[model samples]
Target chain A: MDKVTNEMLMAFVDGELDPAMRKEVEAALRTDPDLRARAAVFEATRQPIASVFDPILNQPLSLPQEGLRDGTEQNRSAVYSPGNPHSRTPGIISWFSGLFQPPKTLSVTVAFCAVFLGGLGLGFLLKAGLVTIDTPEAGLVAFRDDGLVAAGSLDHTLEKYKSGSSFVKTVSDGRELAVKPILTFRDHEGRICREYEITYPATSRYAGLACRTEDGDWNVLIQSPIKSRPTNGKDTVVASGRDADTVDAVVERIIKGDALGSDQEALLMNKGWRGQD
Target chain B: MTEDIRERVIAFIPRLRRFAFSLTGDWDRMEELVQDTCERALTRHEQWKPGTSLESWMCRIAQNIWKDGLKSKKHRAQVSDDSLHFLTGVDGPREIEGRLTLKAVMAAISLLPPDQRIVIALVCIDERTYAETAEILDIPIGTVMSRLARARQALYAGLYDSDTSSACAKAEG
Candidate 1:
């Protein structure tokens, strides 16, 4: 046998080789370390490549309208403008937004309360310009100057809160927001970063990540809206949407080790994030 | 017949999306490509014969869209190489490490040349056979085999081999 080539190994890995050639490659693989190692490359790369895009399958299909007759250029832009929610097809947006609507069977007082809360939430969302594509940093109202600095209530919350702890802070508008720290970990740079979720009662929810800088200031790296599906009486965290996936990808990129345990987080918090890298 | 084509096109959305994601390497662009592919497939339904593989025809439209520069060059260039820096990082537990490895693999695939990338997408990701991929891309089976081999080797080198310095050095040697 004239030594097996990499292409032959790939064909064998893909099961594209004929049985006779496959038998030869298998025999070689059993006896040859270098060939075995080369064969491992195809086997290893195949699994992740096949499964990497599996998440896209479960997402709602965002196809164009059934009878759209316009030019491809015109319809493509109108269907998906990335950050712009309004430009999205109304049917898809309505399907997602409908999940947030209040049920209609509540008492008059409860309905009034729901209306009031919904209005306040809408006001906050509008004031923050979160609905528009122009404001990519819509949820991080506490951070200024390109999210390098965390100030106001968010700064205080990040400094003191432990994982799984929740705090409510009333903004100047008298609307209270619930903030909870989801987890803590040291990033590759050895800086302590926290993943937290903020909920506007029944209105909206966002997940954010921030890391402490050298000067003790928390820098907001990314914040994204999360969808919470109401199951039974409790709200369960469902899909985190595309922006949330970006946050997770960034976390995967920077995280150094396992998320800090509660005891470790407490020790770090007590020492003001000092004496550790 | 037109209704049948429309139904088949809709059914192939997930497969098309996976292929588009591999080629575009970005979610937003993937959606755009899928939409455009769907649009083109329906509008030109006459070109598609009744009994052939509709998925292959749709994939061809997608490849042409991507190759004809419907996707901006600048956006393709923006698939960042940042994941490459973390390839040699210390591993965490199995689940976390598995996820990080997958992310790095995706980033590496994004960097492959368009020809090899599509070959990998069609064969590896979309699970297309050599003959089927050759027919869809209008390339020879030998070319597909070579490209798949090279692409997988590049990915393995870029990802797994980075963690084992001796293996990497030996592979280079």
Candidate 2:
């Protein structure tokens, strides 16, 4: 038999040959020591990997036990099974089927990251007059620099900057043209945290922030009024009459970083007006 | 036919896992990938289109599931190769079944492009004919030949580095 090409030899090794061709290759292999050796090494790999996986066929799958079987499931068997109430994944997440929750970001961390990046950036940017930030009575997210990090392969989480003692309130015009504020959060690093919804009044909208004032009123830590995108008269970023709290282009900003640890966060919430006062 | 297929596939689970383990050096992940594939196929059975070989079709889905699950953030990173890969320090050395050489070969196989990998896994590991592999992949037979050729060369080179010394050296020499 003439010398076979590498492709032919590979095909032969894989048994993709007719009986005549197989006989020819077998004949050649008897004379070719190197070819035989090459075949042996290639063929040997199948056995080891097969041996490695053999137990899996017999082993019943435990969602939690074999969950780490996939690197993508770093959290282990918790896809459908919540470990506990405090550890439950966010309800909004359930809406997105087939969407990989970033193995890295928790819902609260996601909430803060969303609020901080959007709140701070919009808060500070609108203050500087680069963009107009406004909000209805409901707080809006104000992120100028929502520093978001990829939590895992899929989830992009953001880090918020808030402290238990200080929720920076940027006052605009004597009337406080910004929207209302809500609770605050302090990250593990002791930075402040905030959240907001898209709020609108008349022609304008605000991504509100969760800062407060010395007075009992939840202050507008920061707010940005969106210059509404032109639509087909019927299209809307803000529904004409209803409250629309969807995230805008800054969806990436909204979920990042380690969310505030529980103890300090509760302290700020419980002390709310007292802390600012 | 579908009922029979369901029965046969359930029976083939052990066999399929063997094929999967061959592709991936680790057992745990291999099983996970296969289960994901089967689950996906069962739910999306309408797409299976009876009469075609279920094994080839399922094999395609298994590879896709494997591809979906197989991602190494470190491989694409621009970090200097001089430093240990972020995972290297964490996972220790690669998990080889017995010899480091065999493990190295499996990693090489994993690195095959999805196109070639599809063909190789279907044609080689599953022992399907070229026509069967082509049908499963929805490509032409000539494409199968070319990809298989490329896949073979890549495995050959990956299995043995010309200047290096390892378990593969026995085959290289």
Candidate 3:
């Protein structure tokens, strides 16, 4: 007779055996104290693991946004409709929706403007510290008439540079916006999106992700605080959300597949994003 | 037809939430992962075969998202210290000595590698069969059995090992 291995014992504990094998194990256990004891241990081990975490089952999870739990396909489809900004196309929105998606309490700003930076004047103004963004708590950290200016510049730089490359260009205001490309990939929607770090002299530094919207302008997805540290005489940009795990988390959520290589990126840049078409 | 599938996916949310909590050990991240999994499952629900294991399918989606969102190879090693702290709080401080609090069990589960942890969550916690776990994890049945056995053995040692719990108790104290 084959000695009952731990695996077989576990199978018995889990009721995983057919009647013939189960009878065999039962017969073996009837005479073998050691095997029965071992089976008891395996069964005992499963109790805490299975039921210990059961409390969470009763602890009510705040339901997913209104549309998710309503049991209607229209509402469900709205959660990821192509036209919805919160599309889970590459499935990123679902991952960081808690952090990036604004709560119902705060009024969402949905201003769509078609403005392009044609010359260095906008860059100069952007460098001269004129842009201001409204903050609910801090009154106003920095306000820009158009949030798209800084986002657009970062987008342009990403188009021109490869991932892991950084360049500093002095604006007409004598200030520089250091643009560094960190990640570039197609989103769930098959649109090319890039994450970059931007440093504004005498202003603020930010890490942002911008996806190439159907229109020419990039849709600024989410911007989070970045902590800058001087490393080897160069500034190292560190994310400041969720213990600095935000960027990589966001990347993992939205990435459709492996990031685009240089050639693929160039091809994407030339053709532009069209929602997986 | 799509609405019917979405409705079924919604029914699985509570269990999915529990499974996500087991995997992430954080309330906020668990909710988000479940939400993401639901959205993805619905969006790609067309690919899912009808009359098959829907809950198992959703579990697979959640696991994939969790695996992808991990930051590094080390990130996949085990639950982090922060997560351990969070796990400890789940049962609160009212646990009597030697009674086997959920926190202690979670701590032990957290010590397993992420792969093993998922198997434990699906098989042991969610009560998925070995075949079903293999489907959710996309591993072979043999691999699921092997992993579960190792996970069970590790949990047994972690929970019953006097030295390990005493040390943990000291650290908590």
DockQ of 2: 0.07
Instruction: Score candidate 2 by lDDT.
Output: 0.43
Model 1 residue B28 lDDT score: 52
- Which of 2 and 3 is ahead in lDDT? 3
Q: Write the per-residue lDDT of candidate 2 for residues A79-170, one digit (tens) a residue.
A: 43311222233211121212223556435433432332233433533344433222223223322333221111001001221232211111
For residues A43-82, could you state the per-residue lDDT of candidate 3 as single tens digits?
Answer: 7566445544544443322212333323344543444421
True contacts kept of each: 0.38, 0.14, 0.36
Candidate 3 residue-wise lDDT, B1-173, digit = tens: 35467445644655786688788765556666887887788668787898988888889899988888885433533344444332233243323322444556666776777788888888888888998898777789999987788777777767777566543342222
Q: TM-scores across all candidates?
A: 0.49, 0.38, 0.48
Residues B1-173, candidate 1, lDDT per residue (tens digit)? 35466546655765687688778765556666777787788778899887889889999999989877634564452343332122212233223222323345555666666777788888888889999999999988888888878777776666655454443343333
Candidate 3 pairs with clashing backbones: A89-A188, A90-A188, A131-A143, A132-A142, A132-A143, A132-A144, A133-A142, A133-A143
- Could you tell which candidate, 1 or 3, scores higher by DockQ? 1
The numbered model that scores best in lDDT is 1
Deviation of model 3 at A202, angstroms: 62
TM-score of chain B taken alone, every candidate: 0.79, 0.67, 0.79
Cα lDDT of model 2 by residue, B4-85, tens digit: 6544455455456646655554444554556666676666778877777777778878766666555642221112222212
Where in model 3 is the C-alpha error above 4 Å?
Answer: A61-277, B71-98, B165-173
